[model samples]
Target: MLQRVRLAVFLFVLGGFLPSVQADEVWEFVDADGVVHIGNAAPPASRGLVWLSQTPSARGGSGSAKGKEREVSALRLPGYEAAKPHLEAAALSQSLEPALVIAVAAAESAFNVEAVSRKGALGLMQVMPATAERYGVAGRILPDGKHAAMEPKVNAQIGSRYLADLLRMFDGDKELALAAYNAGEGAVLRYGRRIPPYPETQQYVDRVMRFYRALIR
Candidate 1:
């Protein structure tokens, strides 16, 4: 029966659903070539699979199922669990929600502490050097003598503070704040203090909001 259930889950994830099986759980594994696979069941051990996260069912009394799903999704990032302490501390210090910090980090760089964007954004939060300076994260260096933005804790702290400031600037409108974070406060204000119509910024806000809602509970 256990074997059958596992097969059902695998098939459901690969293609269709099994009425007897719920797809509430999520898992991830990396292949030899660094390809990541996300699904509902653990892959074969011979495939060098690593378990990522498991979401709870939403059918319970409270409607926390969605939040569990988002939490699992955020946790699936490679370094998220390792960086949770930093995220929590930063968020608490800035009066921001930890989940929001995690979600932004997830959306920004998939938890890659060394990530650098084409436009020169750096670290887990993709903070540019200028933004880091503005947030008082400048002049800090990692153990390797790299910019502090390349460090997870420093990046999270600066990013959380920036996000908190944006929230206050936008009158606590999370969507607008996120937009300003992606595009720029000038762009948001240019559009009459609304989310800029720029497709990239709009999509960014939506993605962050999805992650935020899923994790916030």
Candidate 2:
């Protein structure tokens, strides 16, 4: 009877219906490239944490009786674990909290190293090309003036350093530094220390905070 109940609960989580029950459960995943991913939920497939198994399930998510999707939780990570070392390095070098770096990475691209914004923010940090080149990225641009941004380590290195610079500029105010990291330092200054009133900026702040809280809880 106990085993049957466990089996039934397992099916519920795979379908995206179970959100609340994932708390207190830490799932482990390893990618094809030998990256280790740990999550409260299964983490996202697109982020390349898919090949993980389950620890039994609770109620929630959709139900499919006979599929691989039936067992895994609704976890969807974007390859964050692979970059953890580099991200942590950059964070530590900058004297910033590594978790904050992870939070930003989670919000910015779910750890998709090659993520590019619709507005042409490039790389994992979503840096504009002009901004990227200014930071001593000596990789020359093509005739089209485009440079490679898929290098996750380089991207995180520069991004975190840039953020550290922002923190110093903002006088050690994390909120303001974070705001500048997202919407530009100018936006933070204009807002008078509050998150800027722009919808995108506000949403960015909220998302980072959510990830931060998730890590905390």
Candidate 3:
């Protein structure tokens, strides 16, 4: 269960990095030293600074990955090939379009599994503990604070399931669901199912929908 959960998390996070032919498929970042580092793997020359894959290629999905829903091959992140199965499973489990989930993940965190928010959120989906528990997440404390949730797979499952739950709660309104995901469902309801006038909340909904709609086409 542990291994499965971990792998599932990786696939979902990495699904946005799709490998492209004739393209360098590389991500370059400059460090404090003003030196550029390239490649999908960590560059020791960058003085222990982690090098992120800016535009990674997607990996082939598991047998389950290829289903009635189309896998957005172009969305996978660089070097994150191990996460396809998890993405596929989560998408199928919640009856969501896998590509849409992948797109939202891409927009949210750019497939950075180690990503942490200014607010101490953790794991691939940037879920906080209270939110994690709300979705029945178990064993959520990685030795490293970066992956404080149980495992990447478990985190993705809970996160995606949480999003699916929000979607259902909002009566299949992706906009409301996304707003809830960003600013809590209560905020959306208090605003009468219309997007709240708050700039941040409305922007959050717009961003997710913008990215999501592109993938749906």
lDDT agreement with native, every candidate: 0.66, 0.57, 0.53
Ranking of predictions according to lDDT: 1, 2, 3
Which candidate wins on TM-score? 1
Clashes of 2: 12
- Residue 37, candidate 1: Cα error in Å is 14
Q: Where's the lowest-lDDT run of ten residues in candidate 2?
A: 1-10
Q: What is the number of backbone collisions in each predicted candidate, taken in the order shown? A: 0, 12, 23
Q: Which pairs, if any, clash in model 1?
A: none
Candidate 2's residue-wise lDDT over 38-82, tens digit each? 455433332232322233364232232322252222224656668
Position 153, candidate 2: lDDT:
76
Best by lDDT: 1
Candidate 3 overall lDDT versus native: 0.53
Model 1: lowest-lDDT 10 consecutive positions: 1-10
Ranking by TM-score: 1, 2, 3
Q: After superposition, how far is residue 15 of candidate 2 from its true place, in Å?
A: 11
Candidate 3 lDDT by residue in tens digits, 30-118: 22222223344322233222222123234242223332122343244542455556655788888987765665555445455655555
